[model samples]
Target: MSKNNKISALSEKDGVNKPEILSSQVAKHIQAFRKKEILATELIEKIIAGDKVALSRAITLIESTNNNHLEKANAVINGCLPFANKSVRIGITGVPGVGKSTFIEAFGKHLTGLGKKVAVLAIDPSSTLSHGSILGDKTRMEELVKDENAFIRPSASGESLGGVARKTREAIILCEACGFDTIIIETVGVGQSETAVHSMVDFFLLLKIAGAGDELQGIKRGIMEMADAVVINKADGDNIQKAKMAKVEFNRALHFFPPKSSGWQPKVTTCSAVTTDGIAAVYDLILEYISHTTTSGYFDAKREEQNQYWMLETINEQLKNSFYNHPEIIKQLELVKQQVLNHEISPFSGAQLLLEAFKKKT
Candidate 1:
């Protein structure tokens, strides 16, 4: 090839201007916002004023493991408490591939369209080996993420059991205080996490796909019992008929269970996330349950019970963290673990020894 005549394929040329994902105005705003350290009081004020950025920062503080952040995080949470509990908390769960992300987006968009502020706290499962998660729920919920009335936060499950983030309950308080009247907590799917999520949310929704053999599976008894609504998602097109069948089966299955304490019967519905079919009915169902419970005064009573449960849970959690983080326990845990593994000591005995050591450390 002649040097001048032959154009080099590898040579770089100025490409057409690529559109900025974030505009210059947004970039500058973000820069200006990040330049100053917001105090707890300012963060609480901003969050109460419905500033999404401040809400996010407060949530970050809540999720942080650093000791220095704990006090401020608590301060912000305490400040938010008076404004919290004004929202309806919904817990959603289903198996993988059940179109949870899609359903949540559709449901969230529906709520926002009604002028209700929505916040989605999505829990992404962490890898057992690397302890990392994709936290891609925000990306999946593109339209909802862009809605000014909606806030979507994807958090890693980390070592927390039950497919929920450790600080999810705290996050809920912050979301409610931030003026999000509808809080949707999406679990990591159906597991022990559902129990945690159930205790925290006012309404528990179980999302399922049609013909998944869930109709006959008694293994889901616990989750089914906890579910205030069993929604068959992906109920459009070819799956419509199957979804109807599943709904019937689920309704029958729900009959086998006793009535909920809230004096509300569980509902079975079918929806398609793609077409957004039957999404509004789900919200209506939630409202009905809320009204029914509120009228009976079970709503506030249940929240009080949950508060007590979480207070004890927090104590247990703090004790566990303190025991593990104690210098003496940290030094001996591995040795005791190795001894148990080598059969030099019984696991129960090793645990007792560790507890004793922790006691002395304290």
Candidate 2:
């Protein structure tokens, strides 16, 4: 049969009248308009309106690994940038048994009672085997979990240094833009991660338990030096005396170090999260520090420095990602590794070869 005859017969069989391209295009446009793809502008508006669901969705976008979502995340952040950096960022670290979650529950409730909104960006330790969060912070922070003014997000740090999640700084910006006045970043109590957390926050807190050896608390002198405040938890019951002694020791240890760049001395305080005793005092100390630093212009300067540090860190991370993810590098990476193992090429030379290959491809 002729092609035109076949087409006409098939079109008639399908009950076709005019199968028009213009009609299909109009339908496509209507569908596109009806589909309602989420926009960066709409998300930003919902976030600024203090909608928690929108806030959570924005964080999820920021944490997403999909390249397509990366642009949207950046857009959300860029949109929110003007509203960010207005809040206090506090980094909290402690050994596993020091009741960190309990303390956070008490602290968050206390802050909300004062009409402050609190957001906790907690880094939970992931299993080396399964790579899942070991501690469920929401279950642990029972009271704060029920508070409308409190937001708790647990990020599993899978094989990351010091159990600090990769996207925590970005999460902080999201929370702040959504109008949370206080952001508490809770890191898994490994000593190495304190530097990572400290670099991102305005104040770094070291939470310690009484009667625990330096080894027990996993706190090194260097970590101690990084702390803006050393708060000894579990200060009630029969442990009060020991807590006091620990405070003195911490104060003495802090005295031996040179003063911080801000010239603000690190303080040692005792608190009982269970009893809520001295909890207010701990926050008072924080307020006092903020007041002194703000009056001295150190608070603003410190935050500005943090922003610069994060920018450089982000650049480094992106360079490493691009280097490893380039097609040319991926193809040769295994061969380069084998050569290094066989001593056929020096490690530095192998690295240079791969880097040159990547550069050429780019």
Candidate 3:
């Protein structure tokens, strides 16, 4: 038969109808699941039981902007607090094209192989204008995503890293409560995200690439100072020598900075994500740092400090949200903004007017 006749046979009037790809029962179950309302107490119980689904739902609740969700999320977080802070929180960052995702995948696999439960909070960069994110972490870390011991959650870094940090910190608590012994927060390598991530993690790792021409320039930024360990990725092929050179340069620059409060010196190393070279050494280094900090009492002290920082950050976030969401403030903000733009009022005056209006409403 000709190609046209062969194709026509399948769609003939008397041909069998296509089978249902989705089962009716399964469809109904999905709909019911979507409509199911989980109480904060139930969520907390399930999360403590190490249910990944429940943990994800709780994080979603925390990220939601709905007032009801915010209240429920707070309740869940409070309930999970007793079980939190038990995990090692590590923050990983690097400039774009530094193979952060690839390295993280390899490192996560190594951790899982050692019988560690790892939860990665990968923050995808959001477009400033559109506020959309690629959220491709699962794609980039395909192996880790499939590993049963590793949970990878991609969150959008919307507008500012402050908001992302708040949500991520809460997510960390949830992840720990879910019995994840290791929590890795992967943030965008640029801007203020590093500072925000640095404040929340027990250890901060800065990823770099060999021959990227950023080693010296990066030294000028505070990221180098914040780094607990710097790992130059993609060290395979002929670039291995260059990576070694970069490591030496990083080490030399690190020595010029003041000693860390933790009394642990930062180390520079090189690794290859593809070949899995030097990956184990990186984990060993992190373990060594953790041991040193824990023995020196800096581990718990830093966590206490982070908790205080989180408290103040939460207050600021709440006040900012309340101000913008206040009915009076929202109503007057446009007019005040126009007045400022038209030179009828100074910028600070407009801000004061909004603040006063917000205060009155409160």
Top-lDDT structure, candidate number: 1
Model 3 error, position 110 (Å)? 0.5
Give each model a TM-score.
Answer: 0.89, 0.87, 0.92
Clash number for candidate 1: 1
Better candidate number, 1 or 2, judged by lDDT: 1
Q: Write model 3 residue lDDT over 1-362, tens digit each, in one string.
A: 78765765457466788999999999999999999999999999999999999999999899887776888899999999999988999999887898999999999999999999999999988888898889999999989999999999999888666435349889999999999999999987776788899889999999998888877775585888899999999999999999999999999889888899999999999999999999999999999999999999999999999999989998998888888888898799899999999999999999998988787778
Instruction: Give the whole-model CA lDDT for all candidates, comma-separated.
Output: 0.92, 0.88, 0.90
Q: What lDDT does model 3 reach?
A: 0.90
Q: Give the residue spans of candidate 2 off by over 4 A.
A: 1-37, 215-220
Q: Candidate 2: minimum summed lDDT over ten consecutive residues — where?
A: 7-16
Span of ten consecutive residues with least summed lDDT in model 3: 157-166
Ranked by TM-score, top first? 3, 1, 2
Better of 1 and 2 by TM-score: 1
State which candidate, 1 or 3, has the greater TM-score: 3
Residue-level lDDT of model 2, residues 1-362, one tens digit each, is 78755664335344558766578788989999767567899999999888888888888788776667878999999998899988888899888899899999999999999999999999988899987776599999989988999999988887667788878888888899899999999989887788999989888888999898762333346788798899999999899999998988888778878888888999999999999998999899899889999999999988888889989988987788788888899999999999999999999999999989999999
